[model samples]
Target: MCFLFLFSLPIDTSDRQKSLPYGTDPEYFKMPTRQHLQASSSSKVNTSAKYHEKDDISSDIDNELSVIFRTLQDLRNLKENSTVSPRTEQKSASEKLLKITELQAAIGDLKRRNAKQRIVKMPQKQN
Candidate 1:
């Protein structure tokens, strides 16, 4: 069991030099050191200036939104002012209804006159 465990452990490659087919050293495959890893992880990036620039744009966006909302309100007011009053609409609707009823009565009179026509059959000559 101990021999199997020892064989399963990874072999150290400190003394061995890995050569490439082009005879160039592998610079990209070097393992990172503790100091290099810590230096990369501890670096602080300052973004306050970028955030302030975005804040200025946010204020401009808010101003534009307010202008759009005000324009919408003005359009609503204009539409309400240009529309006809309820009393005028009611009068026009009643006039249309009266015209429709008169047309329906005229149609009924024509239908009755059409029904009164007799279908006369002519006598055929003997062949």
Candidate 2:
């Protein structure tokens, strides 16, 4: 049994070297240095900055949407209020309609901007 075990062991060092994926080079598994760590951290910071920017844009959209809702509510109130003269109500309604259209255009512009930013940030898949 001892003789069989001895014969089974690899007699050539070249065979061991050949088995290593990186050819036994110590550099292949070297620990990351400070520069590499800093670089990675900087990338993380930039990623976070992008997230903050996106959050800001989202908040702006929310604000615009809230303003639009308020405008619509005002229009409804104007319709219900019998005290207001027809001419004044019509003028207010037209003004509110114009404001709504402007808000819609602004929201559309924001959406397009957000979409563009997303496309720019997306990583390209390598073939």
Give the count of colliding residue pairs in each prediction. Answer: 0, 0
Which segments of candidate 2 are over 4 A away from where they belong?
A: 1-79
Tens-digit per-residue lDDT, 9-123, candidate 1: 9987854655454766686668899998877666532366665454443234345446556654654454233488999777766865675576566556445444433222345
lDDT, candidate 2, 1-127, per-residue tens: 9999999997888876556675567566678999999999999999999986875554465677687778777767754467989998888778988977887887787787778778878999999
RMSD (CA, Å), each prediction = 33.6, 18.2
Off by over 4 Å in 1: 1-82, 118-127
**Model 1: residue 64 alpha-carbon error in angstroms:** 61
**What local lDDT score does residue 7 receive in model 2, on the 0 to 100 scale?**
90
For lDDT, the strongest prediction is 2
